[model samples]
Target: MKHLFLTLATITTLLLLLSTPPTTTAANAADNIVYDVIGEPLQAGQAYYMVPYDYSDVGGGGLTWLQKTKVTCAPYYVSQENVNTNFGQKIAFYPQTPGQTDITLSSILNIVFSSFTPPINCPGTSNVWSVAADPATRLNFIELRGSRGTRDLRTWFTIEDVDQGGYKISYCPRNRRVDCGSLGIVSRDFGRWLGVNGTNPLTFVFESEEFFLNKALGTKSYAA
Candidate 1:
């Protein structure tokens, strides 16, 4: 697959937002958070290609959420579509349960992603901070499962944030196979790959549930 690769000159759009995230208020329980891999917004209702920090198609070739499952993969994006609850299914991801999908800290972040979309230049507008949590336990988690026989393998991540410089934060690991935690933070001084050129800071934002629901539904954009 082809993850949209933005050259230094093309990322002006994201850079502008990144530089301004500092003005945004700290995330509260009831806010829609923005998260992304490589500084792109995970657009709602849009199926997108996803990859781990370890993998790269820097030259413009890589796997996506639509490909064979791996330790980390996703065509993950936000949507009003009811999140898949059937654990038996191939894939699922959501920030909160339907009934209590409140944009509050108490709800707990829950995101379940299953599926793959190959590499392409990743868009700067489709990155989103999906706060996946259990409907019952309300425990924070980021479930990363493989396909079929390997699907049972998973990891849980607790969401945390930073506001000083861009949207700095990590999914701090709760469970998984190898080198878990730090929930994949790679920035100023953390994460799996350090100081790679063209990589984005693992940062994000939280917004009101109502705010994002509308954005997902096409009733709004990030301007609100």
Candidate 2:
């Protein structure tokens, strides 16, 4: 009788554990599993594409479906050979438009969103980003590095949560202790959502991390 009772209790415990859902993580938002490209988490100086994704899409290994052609921020120019070099390597983004006293992350996001499709529709652009993974904080950040003009530039970004392409991005605060508590983020590309003062960190999300498991580099649209 004692052995039977113990066996029943073990079975019940196992069943309950199997039914419980695992805690969601930053990378696993809504179970958005991006496997990686050729053992990804791309290294610094290694070129990759920064393409655009729809608000309802979490880009990943499912091929012949997700359109990989919408890269909004990158500009393309024809080479002398008459071939277009994918977004012309890495391009530098202006921190602020010329002669602007103040700017919001909303404006930047709107610009990128608009560029994703239409007048400024940029194609796949190959670029490199440097990783800044801190083991202590477990907060890994990346900075896009490429030649812009006479000087090379590095743009810092941190990705958090779901909404596919629409996630939260903010530069690490210089103060290091300034944390915006419960700062809610929305999904509209254009609006007066989150503003930035000189002191406050600019919060926005760009399609910084686009991945592919078995696909080739410079991958564009795929039709199912």
Candidate 3:
């Protein structure tokens, strides 16, 4: 009788334990996963095509795609393309945290643009996204760098999900602590440029490299 009672109690406890769901702490719950266009989690070091959030919203007469172009035959500044082009669309994201393969919202990371191909030769040092040190421009213009880390506050950026729709990129380097600035378009030199300013931040989406290649090179749309 005693053995039977003990066994029954143990079974009850096991059933209760199995019925209870595992606890998810606030920290874990708050880590919102940023997904790609196809609803897959974005991974660091993987190439992605950064496309503007809404194609029709950007009323500028052309596609609002991010691309690289030199202003005065110098360092390539990130510029907006009115139409689609083969070059300057590929970019890779690097997380600030070590061993962090999955990119989460509000996490600090470095954006690096891929190198330019033939004919469009522009001798630049680095492709890591960084702000220009131009005192005249208030360091709003985005430029490329050879290397960047936690120590260099100018290199760190954060990805945030906009309330309206899509996501927006911000740069808030650590100066004692992290202070992010909104990234938006600043019109200059008869061109739309990306900079840290009061203008509306450009809402954008990440299209996986695979889809971009298929749509750009092949006939399949790969809509998702």
- For all predicted structures, in order, the TM-scores are 0.29, 0.27, 0.73
> Best candidate, lDDT-wise?
3
lDDT of 3 by residue, 1-224 (tens): 99999999999999999988766754474457777877888889888877777666653321233334445545656766754442236777888898988898888888877543323454555667777655665546776654645457777888988887678888766562423577776776677777775264677778876777777787666443
lDDT of 1 by residue, 1-224 (tens): 13455565468777887788553465442254444433334333333222222222121211212211233434342221112111111222243334442222222333333343424553321222333443453333332222222212232223444444223224343353233333322222111221111143333333334544565578866531
After superposition, the stretches of candidate 3 with alpha carbons farther than 4 Å from their true spots are 1-20, 23-31, 59-73, 84-88, 116-124, 176-179, 217-224
**Candidate closer to the true structure by lDDT (higher is better), 2 or 3:** 3
**lDDT rank order:** 3, 1, 2
Ranking by TM-score: 3, 1, 2
For model 2, residues 124-187, the per-residue Cα lDDT tens digits are 3323222233355443323222222222212232334334333343444334443322122211
Q: After superposition, how far is residue 203 of candidate 3 from its true place, in Å?
A: 0.3
Who wins the TM-score comparison? 3
Give candidate 3's error at residue 75 in angstroms. Answer: 2.3
Which has the higher lDDT value, candidate number 1 or candidate number 2? 1
What lDDT score belongs to each candidate, Candidate 1 first? 0.32, 0.29, 0.68
